[model samples]
Target: MKRKKNNKTGLYMLGGVVFIYIGLFLFDSAKALQAVEEAFGVLKMVLPIVLVVFFLMGLVNITIDKEKISRHFGKESGMKGWFYAISAGVLSHGPAYVWYPFLQNLREHGAKDSLVFAFLYARSIKIPWIPLMVSYFGLSFTVFFSLYIVVASLLQGLVVEAFSKAKR
Candidate 1:
């Protein structure tokens, strides 16, 4: 059986494009084109980083066993589980949306709420940006900021776990 198509999203996208074109025509055409070119330039710069992150994600999906994930991240996994989650989060790359599916899979496989929160929160610290941060903000400031984020991530996880428990 053929399923009916959802037109809402398509309509919204069409409306957005229409509005952009209208705005372009109403304003300076040359400026609008320039803006578009600049936006594409930024996208070109970011595309490689995004692609690499997805590639690594694919590798992880293929090599990591579901049962092992459950064993390490399950509700009964304890502090060690939190450690693993936090470390993974710190090392995780790409946009937040890219990690959603993996996180959902972990949740389905019995991962604890606290560990999940820890992972999500710890993503605030991008390891690859550390050198840049140090260069821009001084090593001492960067070190402290990173340490603070690590502690805050753990605390955030605990708070989320408490709230989740309370809800249950």
Candidate 2:
């Protein structure tokens, strides 16, 4: 039953995409073709990364003990939880949406709301981009920006925790 629902959801999303392209083509054929070409270009770049991410996610789902996640990232895990979340976020690559399902699983397994927020915020600092950023903006600026993002991510987590608690 659940599988059927999931299939339907996937079909709906696929249909939506098809509808969008059709609409665009109807409105302006040349522009629509251009958009399709641009989309394919992006897909070529992103698909490989997405596939690797999914493969890794599968490994994680199989190997990582759910109890460990709950123990470390639970509401009472405190600063250590924040550190782990931020670190994971920084190390994560590929598009953000790719992380959503894994993150949602973490949440379901007792990961704190604050840590989730921290993880999302800390994703801004891509390690691979550091060299390019330094070259473009200078070492001092890049270093400072990275540090600021780390700090801001922690702060954002704290604020999210506070707000969540208040709402509850």
Candidate 3:
């Protein structure tokens, strides 16, 4: 039964390619190829960085106990969760994508999904990026956005928690 399903899936994939080719062939073939090449170029550039990051992440996973990390940052006492989230946001480097493995590790170690979401939200509201955002949007909008993001992060955690409880 599974084999029959897999064959059907393969046939569907081939049909999709034929459909796409028909569309592109009837449309602008040159533009489609150019877009494909540009996408491949982007993938080529990112692959090496991702490989190195993955390697480093493997080392961290092997060396550290993520449960300890969750214990260190997951505490909500004395506004510590916010501070931890903010500090982790600032001190962490590289693309936001890089943090997923670590965040997943934290989650496996009993960190709430909302806390992970908050960390990422806080990271996006980077302190250094504030000047750039202010320069582009001006102080009023920038301040509002910043405050909005912080409140939203905590609220996000709470909402997700509520949803999880509801699911049970």
Candidate 4:
């Protein structure tokens, strides 16, 4: 029943988008065509990332054991879990939205909410940007900010854990 409702909502949103496009086309055909072209261009770039994410999801499902995921990211995972999550976040690249499905898959396999939040928060510390940041803001500022971000990620995770409704 919930799945049906979700599908219905999706269809409605798609229909609304189509109708809006139709209206735009009628109002200004050339502008509408340009909009469509830009939309397709964005999709073309994003599609590959989405495909890679799916491939990674499948790889994770096939190679990583559920018990291992739980051990690393689940309840009682301790500081080790935080370390893993923060490390993964810093290492991960590409748009953050592309990771949502993969994260959801992990959660389904027993990843904790706190760890997920920590991962998301830690993503702000882009390792590749560190050198650039240091050049612009000085080494001390960059280093301190990076360290603060790590601490903040842990706090964010702890807050999520405190309010999380999911059973461990």
lDDT of 2 by residue, 1-168 (tens): 011226588789989999999999999999999999998998897888778777766776887776777779986677789889999999988778878777776776668878888999999999999999999999999989989999999999889878888887
Assess every candidate by TM-score.
0.68, 0.82, 0.64, 0.77
The digit string of per-residue lDDT tens for model 1 on 42-63 reads: 7786677667766655765787
List, residue by residue over 1-168, the lDDT tens digit for candidate 4. Answer: 001225487689889999999999999999999999998998888888899899999988999988988898987688899999999988888778889889988888889888888899899999988899999999999889989999998999988887765533
Clashing pairs in 4: none
lDDT for every model?
0.78, 0.84, 0.69, 0.87
Give the residue spans of candidate 2 off by over 4 A. 1-11
Model 3 reaches what TM-score against the true structure? 0.64
The candidate maximizing lDDT is 4
Q: What is the lDDT, from 0 to 100, of the residue 79 in candidate 3?
A: 60
Q: Model 2: how far is 3 from its true place, Å?
A: 18
Clashes of each: 0, 0, 0, 0
Highest TM-score, which number? 2
1-168 in candidate 3: lDDT tens per residue? 001224487689879977886688679988878777886897787677677768766775787665565666544322676567656765555578767766665666556676777778776676767788889999999888878887887877778767877987
| Cα TM-score of candidate 2 | 0.82
